[model samples]
Target chain A: MRMPKLTAFLMATAVFASALVASADEVHVLNWKGYGADEPWAIAAFEKATGNKVVNDFFNSEQEMLTKLRTNPGLYDVVMINAAFNDQAMAEKLIQPIDVSKIPNYADISADKAGSPMLARDGKVYGVPWVWGLTALAINEKAFETPPTSIAEMWNEAHKGRVTIRDDAVEAVQFGAIATGQNINDIKDMEAVKAKLTSLMPQIKTFWSSENDWNQMVASNQIDIGTYWSGSADRAKTHFKLPVSLVIPREGAVAWLDAFSIPVGAKNVAGAEAFINTMIDPKFYVEWVTKVGAPVSANAKAVAALPEDAFNRKVMGDPGVAKRIQFQAPISDAQREAYLALWQELKVNVK
Target chain B: MAGQVATGARSGLRSALPLLVPAYLWLTVAIFMPLSAMVFFSFMTELPLSGKAWSFTLDNYATFFAQGLYRTLLLASLKLGLEVTLWCVVIGYPAAYVLAKVFRGRSREAIFLLVILPFWSNGLVRIFSWAMVLREGGILDTALNAVLPFKINIDLMYSYPAVIIGLVHSYVPYMVLTCYLTLQAIDDSLIEAGRSLGASRLQMLKRVIIPLSMPGLVAGAALIFVPVVGSFMEPRILGGRTGTFYGTIIEDQFVAVFNWPLGAALSFILLAVVLVILALASPVLKRAA
Candidate 1:
């Protein structure tokens, strides 16, 4: 009798375990930490709604993201890629085109963001546009009585030793291109960009590499003005109560779009699509932007749902600001290497 | 007799092979294999794993030689390594002497722990702490202003000196620990004899104590100089705009530019430079030993 009872219990446990495994599919997501896909609350909501469990991995840089995708094939079900890198991912065959019909919310993406050349190859959409933001000038509210309107303020002799910029090669070159009244994506005059950046070096107090570093510098009064991300500026101002205000100068700012892509050979394509769709849902976007600061949503309906005074809307809502924005484009590997070499050379010569 | 000796040696080797296998296997997997792979990759045109076109090429190495920037940065890193090692010796030698010769029993143990306390925390945290003390409105500036009659700005953040200070703080413990081991092993009677023979304190330190501890000093210098020469974090965190170095440039090649071949060549070049430096120092090290 005791043996029979034990057998019955063992069989029951096996059945329950199999039931649990069959009902929930685990989706592995690779993204930047704190990005929408990784937020605990969003993950919980997705799991509850779709019976799909979300697991997250994070990368610090877009290059690192690509490295992970290349090296760990089939390990990640979903990856968040900057649109500028989507072409490279497709060329490497690391990510697959998403079937937009599977993602109901994909249609809600803003028309401009939907038509991004980087996200699609030929006709199929390889990436689902998620968020967009600007790398623009942010100033200490206390330092500027009237907000500066020109990118040239960074090089003004009066602000010498009080200015800063990011330490990325691509961003720095794009910034220099803008300052020289050239297109960020297609600058014809390399020498002019080089000369303009070199002249700005004396005015630079230092270079910041991360959002945390930028905030620390501002909080300690280390720098009064610097190039910073629009979303991060909102967080610094509203969440941390930092005295910073993001400004889109007349010369324009560099715009970047991030997207969610399903990696080729992903085991759980259905689960990955569900996760992406849920992330773009207006309900989720509104909650994410209102509670935790984020880049402007790519879903037009989600943007409309945001409060009238939302930080993203106030700064990015103006159509004129959109006209002035220069979206980053795919840069060839050789061009990127040249930019890196030039940036390194410039940094080495800094006194 | 020679045949018998050879047979005996062969038997000894056969017996020892089993005991040596694990260690050799570990070394092959951990050190030799990775190094061989890097050397192989350094000669390639592109990373084979990237599914890109590839070929054997010397362009990576050629780029390093053709560009004067790499050479300049390498020299700067060597200079930084030398300066930091010197500061470590200056600050650490005295403290090590006190721990080895002056303090006794429990006091010695307590003070020794204090010397190595910095290692308990993360290197990044320690560097950040120095930033707190060295920044313009930091603790040092506040304390100085309170005492001094005139106002003075003491901003050291993002400066070369700040980098030097942070590095010394992080590595001085190595000098102290190594020197302490050798200094403690020296017989006190030798010092007493030197004193009895009319050698002054300075002369005793220069002639007896230093010579006896030369092995430890050289070891500490080697340990500190190698890592300091390749250091990128402290310089990046502290030196700011002026922080560009050979190490950081190599880091960019691998992470930023995805130029693994160039990064590998650069790394091998740095390894060669370090090996040459060690080879130069071996004569002194052997003499001291």
Candidate 2:
């Protein structure tokens, strides 16, 4: 009787341990809503392939994402952070260096993105560069006889009361920096930037805050030319059928990258790696790009696999464009406050 | 006799304690605790939870005093509040008088529903709907151009007037609802007495209706003015580049610039100003009561 009871107890322990292991396979993801990670089909495919369940939470802004990570340590196994904020995340120890070996698809990522200083620290990779896009000029094709070649066209008298820009201090300051022939990440003369933005104010009909706002403003002819995202511009033209064309001016454009990283003290590190690998897979990239209209894939193989006339392939595929692009860098808190103050002052004086 | 009264009062307190416990507990948890925490944070140099080195500092409040922009925007917001409140009163008082004095039975109920209809829809959808009506080739423009002999462009989107229109549309219902309640409560005999005294219809309204409805009018103005002073959304959606206000700047400090300490300070300042305004209006409100 004693032997039989002991055997039954051992069996129960084995079953409970297996259940624990199964529960541990679940991956919690933090990302922007609708930004590739939480796609239903992708999540289903990843779950089926790796036998790991995926759950997602979304943040509306990058700062909100940071706050979430800081407040909820060990809750999120995977997080999507912008390249510009990678250093700050790393410094705060919010995310850990990802083991690239676990992500087999990492080999196919473009060297420029994979090796970017923004994603690495002291020879260790903290993030897997996922997607990139440009914040360049998007113009109403029907409104212009010829495409604008320079960022200075935003100030042209012809487009007065027909031009717009985003209502963001960082974007406005960066645009000013670019127009003044200064690096976006490093501006030596903020006075020049302030002066440039102040002059552009009268030409602006309005300022858009979201992709929907941009679409409405342009569709109604409330604006003729404005600073817009490349991916959003592509969606406007292809999905909404708006007569919009993105222009990479002679002064180049502001570029930003988004990456997937494992949060520090995550319970399911392997599951997080598996999810990120699936996220950057070429097949997934092609589907996301063609159907949903996403930013350009960081994976070189994925871009090459897209159709010849794919908007990203036609516009951002050139190596020369890569050289001209200025990838955003981490901004100090003091610098951000200064930009905000200047932007607010300019908005107050716009009329 | 005093001792007996004190005993009675103690017994009354003992009886009411159980009923008041839940309410006081809720207030302590939901309102006072958070407000106390905000007060503490307003004096800090940084967010204490951000894992950064921080200490108590008066710099946050000092920045407000040193900067002229905050004062300018706060004044602008006050002006906006005053304009919106006056418009609500001008538009709503007459409608309320009609609802209370003229309309009867089912027609009154139907019109009353129409007055409160703006509350049925989401605030954003309503604002956007106004945008559709007020844009250049929008409903208003299209209708006007279709009926008129000459082509007149009505590009009101992204202007100050658009913001005012959207805000007034949103808040006028408050004025109507409050004034209607008060006007309905006033004895109809008062108006009859005024008219029997050989008063004109206008004189009857000025003497009998307006004075009696003062409570509701004061209540409605307070309701509209408080929110409008701190409003950021309607102004943003409709006012375009012209939309930057004190409230929007405070929003920027927290969300865009990650300056929570400064945001807390600015918020505290706005709260203090609002309190002072309410304090100044208390005598009038009490008199109306």
Candidate 3:
């Protein structure tokens, strides 16, 4: 009376392999941190809708992901790279020109979400936007009598030995320049950036390397304020039950997007398109953002269906917020070397 | 004494040349070849590709000298290496002595097996196991928190002290094994003869037992100190980004920083430091023997 589980298993295995060996039934994907890990709803829906298994690999940085895709010709079906890297990936013939006709759910995504740097390029859609966020000043209201307003306030004498700066070169250098009203994009102006940083360095209790770090410093009032990503700031608030306000500074901010695109060598074109379509579903998008604490740019109606407070608190919801922020593009290889060299110099020269 | 040692050494070498040649060849191919490549790259601003060598430049050398990071990190590693060696020497000597002297047959094997338990486990896992014990809100913290009336939670992970502790824990077994071998090699009759001479318990240990153990102590110190100086992980995990030793910067330059030439130059600088330490240590070893 019992159906054979082994038969079902064999069928599933055949389908999975054909997706890899053949080109139609499996979606080979690459995405960055916190984006591609097992999301049960997305996986189930994608499989059911398209009869495709979503085979995914994760990359930590845009540099690594882009480099891998560039060096390897046709290994991946779909790769999620930032808008900045799309130029190189195109120039190198690393990515396939995405066929929007293959992906139908692309129509459902609104104008605002599609306009993200990673998804839209030169009047053509290359990818779909996933996570868009800004690095900001996280203020612990419980620690301070009055929380500071902007990035500059974090380095004020009152916050001495209580402010934590991120160890990231881009965030530290950009926030330093932006807080002081300098062009954050100009890497050549090291003296101006260094001057601002050297002044602020002493005020910083410690430089944080990982997002998981600085929780104790902020929560326990050892550090009253710090440079933090929105997800981290929100989690700190939720975990410690502290009134942590994630503040985007007056002097511009940094915005980044993780996007998915098919690589040139992709074996499973149909499956990849199916997976991308599955990700765009309003119901799936709503569940992902709510669970993951990252507001992915998706269907507005789906996002609106969430609780009012949760929707409002979603950092990605503010249009003006994104406008003020600059997204990083892969600088020319020469400039990248220069930036790293300069960063090394900065680390040595500063405390 | 020098002449005697030289002749004796020559005889020993002649006898062991067949065994020594294979080891020497292995060391050259495995270690020296890579080392020479690094040294060569240190002098080059850019690496040779397609059988073409880049123009030799000392920018890496200059960076090493100018930034003075090499010096600071080199000095930090040296200080930590010495501390780690001292820790192993202090802890391992007595433990090794107990294993060799007090325990015998099956009991000795069990105790020695206990010492080797950590060795059987992966080095990273062992260090992490210690991290689990020592880190804040970890095993030790929970235990202390339960017993202590106040916040006596010792924030052990991401501290220099924790690294020193981890280094000591990770490599102490090597020190124990080295010392135990030397202790075992000592004839039991010599210890008896010292006792028979009516030397005090302390005198017997100092005059007879300790002199024989000097070689083990020195060997153990070398094993612990040299590798610990070049260690990257223990310090990085334990220190966090608050700061790190010299090794971390060197690693970042190669892997993440993507400046192999600079990293190579730093490697040579570290190698020089190692050579200097070994040169300094040679005299102490000679005197001990």
Candidate 4:
């Protein structure tokens, strides 16, 4: 039994070794599922124009991406990471500085969004904003005739078994702080946050990790209200044909930005730059945002090109919408450790 | 004659070396080296790979003892393991008995194959399939409601029970396969002998058949319990809000918190617990063997 398996393994290893040695003109990209160059047109058009094939790989989180880049050097050309992780990525030198000159489309970014600290370090641009969205309440209109207006509704006894919260420690703790009338960014009393999270345990039917998890819960009528991403809400409504809509509660929502950057040991720098430029093209952004459902575009031309009834225009054009949503901010490792500890306590106490 | 025998034994050893070396080499590279590395890393304050300034510390293990939450979560995971294994035994043993004893000829072979068929598909996909069947307005609900006179809510998704159901469904096949092999190996004449010696049906089952199949029960229990203790995905997908366990926290350390040292320590602790359980069970297992 083992002899046959051993022979087969040896044969397979020989095949893979040869495959790795064979050179190809391809820009290997590492990103989140369904993100940049994952679109057929982006890959097809890039390959047609640049004569470089696109290879895509994905990770579920920034930490996983960082680990891959650190461990598997030269495996990926372009990577998309959360804006909040730019400092750590730079400090570790896992990613290299961006050559803005090579990417002419860098000028397409709006001044306000371009000022993000994640974009520049030591006066050198590192990454370009790829997509941005907010974590807010996604309610099924069929379940809620009047949309919920506050994060407090997540704890309402009336909807005890219909509420789904995010499973993320930072997001859950931040929202817990927000629900208890504290600034989410500057959490002073972790005990208070943990207490708040513990109190809401009875109300949550389940905790979801991904946008697809939230969508499935709502689509199947398993959950009526959830802490969901705005982009996911749009996708769920269109794809699942569910009566779901995203509403930023009175306590506000956490906004996050993902940016494209070149890894330190990229073999195809020119191809990687071309891919990023192609991703930010106004025409591409317009079609990308509309079809894929992004909350907003960082590209000035793309933002201006939105139609009157477009999802981004309606959401981003609202007065003080940008101010109301709290952008993703970096936290000290000590704070992160403290928050994780409290999160453990909250989870353990979830009887 | 003694010198010739010694030369023959030496040749036998040389012949076996080629096969034995590969297996031991594989074990050293795959299991032993990683375990040693994990142990070494568990003593560090930070990851050594990043070339960041780091120092040796016992804080990772210390933190496990410092927090009551970790202890509680470990106990909960152990309880979950027990619950799942017990359910597997309750559900799988009867099916194994039916297939081995009651079913005959072509049907027995087909039924045995059908019992283990779910194992062929992806475990993750099978777990997710249960989500579809157990969720609100799902297949089970729709089917039951269609047959019943009165409408009723039958949603079981996201609850603790759903996690148990999904795990049992996923692991029951292992128990069935193990128990079936042992049950089939037991001579039917021995069971008949027990019955002919004034033993009732229950006595024959409890005395002759069950004692003979103890090895299979122990083997299946060990198989199910070890993985169940380390399981995170099943709870996450099926348990919903109630899914957090020791395994998930260990997952969070490596993936979410970027705390490799702490994760390693936690994993080591879980390994110790599993070793202790197996050690305690070894006596009974030896007797059965």
Error of 2 at B92 (Å): 0.5
Consecutive 10-residue window with the lowest summed lDDT within model 3 chain A? A1-10
Candidate 2 residue lDDT tens string, B1-289: 4355446778786777787789889878656766676778889998865668899999999999998988989899989999999999999999999999999999999999999999999999999999999999999999999999999999998899999999999999999999999999999888888888899988987778888899999999999998899888898899988988888887787668767788878888988898899999899788866
**lDDT ranking, high to low:** 2, 1, 4, 3
lDDT of each: 0.88, 0.88, 0.69, 0.81
Better of 3 and 4 by DockQ: 4
Which regions of candidate 1 are displaced past 4 Å?
A: A1-24, A71-75, B1-25
Instruction: Please identify model 2 stretches exceeding 4 Å from their true place.
Output: A1-23, B1-25, B284-289
Top model number, DockQ: 4
Q: How well is each residue in A168-242 modelled by candidate 3, as lDDT tens digits? A: 655676776677676666655667777777777667555676755567555434567888877667666655566
Second chain TM-score, each model: 0.92, 0.92, 0.87, 0.94
- Expressed as tens digits, the lDDT of each residue in A1-351 for candidate 4 is 112223433453454354342134788888877764698876888899999988877776666677667766776788887888887888888889988889888898877667798668998878888778888888978788789788887788888888888877888888887777777778788778877888888888888887778777776767778788877787777666878998888777888887888988788888889988888888788877767766577787777798877667777557577767788777767778777887777777885
Model 3, residue A186: C-alpha shift (Å): 2.3
List, residue by residue over A208-300, the lDDT tens digit for candidate 1: 888888888889987879899999999999898999999999999999999999999888999999988988899999889877889999999
Each prediction's TM-score against the native?
0.92, 0.93, 0.78, 0.89
RMSD to native for every prediction?
A: 7.9, 8.3, 8.4, 4.6
Superposed on the true chain A, the predicted chain A of model 4 yields a TM-score of 0.88
Candidate 2: tens digits of C-alpha lDDT, residues A1-351: 012222432453353344332247889898999889988988999999999999777877787788777867777899999999999999999999888998999999999899999999899999999999999999998789989899989999989889989989999999999999999999999899999999999898888889999998878877889999999999999999999999999898999999999999899999998999998999999999877899999999999899998889988998778888899999988888888889999999874
In model 4 chain A, where is the ten-residue run with the lowest total lDDT?
Answer: A1-10
lDDT of 4 by residue, B160-237 (tens): 999899989989998998999899999988888887789998888888888899889889999999889888889888
Each model's DockQ?
A: 0.32, 0.33, 0.13, 0.40
